[model samples]
Target: MDSQPPSTPPSQKHGQTGNHSRSHLTPEEQRRIEVNRLKAKAIREQREAEEAKRIPHPSPTRGTNIGTGVKRSFASMSSPQGPATLRDGRTGAIHTNRPLDSIRPARNFAKYVEYDFSKMTDTKGGFLTEDDDPYNKALYVRDGKKEQKPAHMTQKEWDRHQLLKSTRRDDIMVSGSKQNTCCECGSLEIDRKWEEAFGCCVCSSCKEKYPEKYSLLTKTEAKEDYLLTDPELKDEELLPRLEKPNPHKATWNNMMLFLRYQVEEYAFSAKKWGSPEALDAEFVKRESEKKRRREAKFRSKLQDLKKRTRVEAYRRNRNGPAGGNFGDDLGSGSRHVHQWGRAQENPEIGMDIKKCVDCGMEVEELEF
Candidate 1:
């Protein structure tokens, strides 16, 4: 069998260039193809432009400029017109045109005033004493000086002002008279003498006593040089010597031995010394003065009583027993004891408080 020639459309046979592959064409398809090609080109150009904008510029500090011998100055990485771009303050748009010098000063809008620390007292890392109140306090300053009459505040608020002074240590003021209730018993029978019993202040109560415990701590150690150089004893001395610790007492009294040694080693004597007799004389004087004051107080109270008695006698002499017209309405001058006995005996006597027969409960008058 012989091969046959492929079938060719009439458009190809006649060399029609517009529809070179096909025998026929539509106008809409040609237009759509051209539009698609144009869109692809536009998208590629836009992506390239965005990539150029994303690329960062080199800063001065990382490398030196070839032209200049001096070190390169670098702007803040967070600032605008640098490798890290920032939004404009006013417009909120990405900034890149201006240098850092132009944008930095404007970026820091706040004005900070310097404070004066010359008057500030040194704390020395301890509880501040009462004398440090004036020195430790500070005032607000703008440009190394005090701020002019800033603002007026209420008395309560002014008392709590920031410049108000305070001590670092805790102050405990125990007012005995103001303390009415005992902390232990919750009874209103507290007295001034309760705090004297304990070394530390505490509330008064007879029902129970507060249970407390104490521990002795060694805050310092004794040195060998002082003990050996003592005049009372030598290093190679006998019993009760400064160099040797008490064998019997030292077994359970390590802290006491250390304290005794420390005090004896470093103890300094005062220039002026007062004897025991002097202290006794002063105490006797105080006692005598206290006794005189008590006698004076008693005499004053007696005088007050005498004056009251005289006034009562004068009133009784001026008017009769019950005192004029009002006396008749008030009845006889018999004592209230007699009426109280009759009222208790009377079965129909009504009272605010009554004895109950059943539960033996007394009915008490209750306030609204």
Candidate 2:
């Protein structure tokens, strides 16, 4: 048998064969190959240019490491240990690293300089020194001046001053106390109940004496009294005046005056419409009837709303998992009972049934 030729390696065989095969191609093929070669070369050069642009330039001072033979532009020098070996450029003198206070001037330097005052003059064309005199030196008129008591105060003056100060102090104390005195008896005693209700103070004795006037009367009663006294007022004007009671300045007298004004105004308007007393009675009756109807309607709507809310809550709990119905017992009526009964009859209808981990009983389990 003839010895087989040595097998060619896969890489070398394909490379060499490809080159040789391309070389024997037609003119068109050769041109195509050349064009492809140039395209690849251009692409490589373009990539190289982009990479070079992305790199940053090296700093002059912060050059390559010392071992790389690269040198820095300037050397970093530490502070000198003793007197500086530098000199001042302008003065051409040696400069030392001593504290500023320790530096001494040259012997030839002048110690003092004098200013010429002979040519100086005031704004009025008078010599500046013409007003100066040895006997008339500048005096600090305001600096030493202070408000001081007379060196010798008379006994009468002292007594008057003390009396004025004591009176001022007493007035301040009285105002700050905010205590009300009864106008009738000039007594400091206050009726707290009357004050709280009417926002005004009146002594018990006065209130007892004038029952109809000061006996903790309601705003309505006061208004009626005012209307009885002045029966020619209008409601349009009266209502606004009655509504705006000044609580801060509200004394018994002030409140009564306001009520009286409201009633008088209402009566005047009522008289224009008809008999003042008859019109007032009719108005009261109509308002009371309207109020009753409104309250009844509100109650009916409130009940319906509460029922609808309960029905919605019941529906939600019935459809959801049994374990999440934690508040089912909080609802009222047979609806809640019926839901509980349904849940018990079909335990697996709304939730998964699982064994309890602790008690090992068949219990409803929630799926997360």
Candidate 3:
């Protein structure tokens, strides 16, 4: 070691390596750096605190995920007073912690079960505790067998038959009879109009008395006045109507007559116009559009009229002014009239220059 220090490698020829021989700071400089670092750290912490204050604290009820503040719908179940289970209105599904495939109907619904067509009822024991005899059924029931397709039927025809036969009629109301008593005044005497036409139990006195509610509404009146849509008025199930031959034309389609109250109810409901105010707004908008179209039409007609008048005036002037050879230019034999414009001074020539208003012909004349 004392004899000779090992020669440094060429790669290690420059400054000290491996963090050795570092620059040493003075106490003041080190203090300043430490102070600045502490100040920066404090500022950063303060900013973080402010940011935390600005946003709501992460809550378990907010969502399973952190940061986002969206209130979870399922969060209520975690509470003490939540419902035992959540039920879906449309799907009739009971919400649970399990997977979708694992979920099932609470009770065995006959509609979902396989068909047993030898019997009138769907289920083995029937839905009722006491199975009523088929002949004495309160309502008409039909549940055709799966294997009941007619002989020599093609695959297409068989498939179509199966499709039509698959309709579930377990809970359907096919036909029923109602009481003969009047729905309005309870009078034994009811109108033939209500009973025969609309199949409603309403007396003739009530029909005339409550004109606003019981009165008939034509298809045109329902659409234009009440702002009802085609689907709403056309659907017999939705709004029952009476049909009659068109009074205006026999060849035309039959007129549909809807009850005034039914039309009004549908019109003001959430489905159509929503409210009276909304209907009024729609009417105003339509009227304004109609007025704008009318004005535009009038403007177009006026422009055409103006163009026609201008063309006629041009033709009259070109063919020579009516009843006039009076203003013909000298030595030309052409019938051209000079409707002269106001005279302007020609200062250099000490004369007045006049130009034709229509033809742009100019003439000079000495004037005092």
C-alpha lDDT score of every prediction, in listed order: 0.42, 0.50, 0.67
Tens-place lDDT digits, model 1, residues 72-130: 23333323445433335555444445556565443455553233445445677644443
Candidate 1 residues lying further than 4 Å off, grouped into runs, are 1-10, 14-273, 320-323, 327-368
What is residue 66's positional error in candidate 3, in angstroms? 99
Taking all chains together, the TM-score of candidate 3 against the true structure is: 0.37
lDDT of 1 at 85: 37
Which of 1 and 3 is ahead in lDDT? 3
> Sorted on lDDT, highest at the top, how do the candidates line up?
3, 2, 1
lDDT of 3: 0.67
Cα deviation in Å at residue 183, candidate 1?
Answer: 42
Best by lDDT: 3
Residue pairs whose backbone atoms clash in candidate 3: none
Q: Per-residue lDDT tens digits of candidate 2, residues 270-301?
A: 44434557657766887799999999999999
